[model samples]
Target: MNSFLSTSTARDLSLIFSGQGQQRPQLESILFEITIETSTCETAFADIQYVSWMQGEEEILITIGAIVRIDS
Candidate 1:
């Protein structure tokens, strides 16, 4: 009953992957496809540069963004 939950803020792209060894209940693995300029292909970012609008919102944002959970 475990799985993965993925979401993209820029696009309404969300899905779940569930199986035998993939039962981690996290977004640990991502096989995404992105489009840039006139070319489209699969890609992933090694690191993210996240900027917060609020002064005291760094911890909150990081915590929320790192969450990939299941409702048990």
Candidate 2:
């Protein structure tokens, strides 16, 4: 089944993290910088920033059902 991936238009959003909690330090973290280019008519995703409750997040709502691959 598909899922909703909450993403942001802000390039600087902290998507992942690494820190010390256990006796050993946590492993390094990675972030996938996804660049999405779509026509204005595309409906796979929607810009909900204005209506979003978390206005500061600059969120973009994506429908995973329409997503086939990361390379697209």
Candidate 3:
């Protein structure tokens, strides 16, 4: 028989804009950097069991899971 073990974590991040004027190119850059950094850590783990992303009007959601194989 074969089996798999998995673990996952999720976090929601928000960048509040007080007004339309708050929108700026730099803000987008920062958000992009954050997304990249969050995903990079997964590469070091074994196979990624699952991953998902959801975008909201004001926040971004990320879910990541990792799996490891056990020998019996």
Candidate 4:
């Protein structure tokens, strides 16, 4: 069974669209570089920036039970 996970891009939009983000470890945080490969999986996300209450946050709504690959 696959679990649902919520992820979002921060201030830099490149994080989500271009897979560009910090690789260094933080004080108390685990960072996973996620890439949305359409060829491998179905579309399971929606751009909710326009409908979100806080539009400035630039939120991307991911569907529940979406499958993703995680690398360590």
Highest-lDDT candidate: 2
Report the C-alpha lDDT of model 2 over 1-72, residue by residue, as the tens digit. 566767787755544222223344455554555566675435477789999998978888777765434653
Task: Give the per-residue lDDT of model 4 (tens digit) for 1-72.
Answer: 343345566646534443445465543444566677758768577777788787766766666767666776
List the pairs of residues colliding in candidate 4: none
- Which runs in model 3 stand beyond 4 Å of their true positions? 11-45, 49-72
Colliding pairs, model 3: none
Error of 4 at 42 (Å): 1.1
Query: Judged by lDDT relative to the true structure, which candidate is superior, 1 or 2?
Result: 2
Cα misplacement distance, residue 57 of candidate 1 (Å): 35
- How big is the positional error of residue 55 in model 2, measured in Å on the Cα after superposition? 0.5
Which of the predicted structures, 2 or 3, would earn the higher lDDT when compared with the native? 2
- Per-residue alpha-carbon lDDT of candidate 1 for residues 1-72, written as tens digits (9 for 90 to 100): 232223233322223332234657664654343322225313322212154343232211122223223333
| TM-score for each predicted model, relative to the true structure | 0.16, 0.58, 0.16, 0.53
User: For all the candidates, what are their Cα RMSDs to the real structure?
Assistant: 14.5, 4.6, 13.9, 6.5
Instruction: State the lDDT of candidate 3 residue by residue for 1-72, as single tens digits.
Output: 233322223222322332233756664422222323445455333324233233233233333443323333
Compared to the true structure, candidate 3 yields what TM-score? 0.16
Once fitted onto the true fold, the runs of candidate 1 whose alpha carbons sit more than 4 angstroms away are 1-14, 17-22, 25-27, 31-33, 39-72
Which runs of model 4 end up more than 4 angstroms from their true locations?
1-5, 11-28
**Cα misplacement distance, residue 39 of candidate 2 (Å):** 2.4
RMSD of 3: 13.9
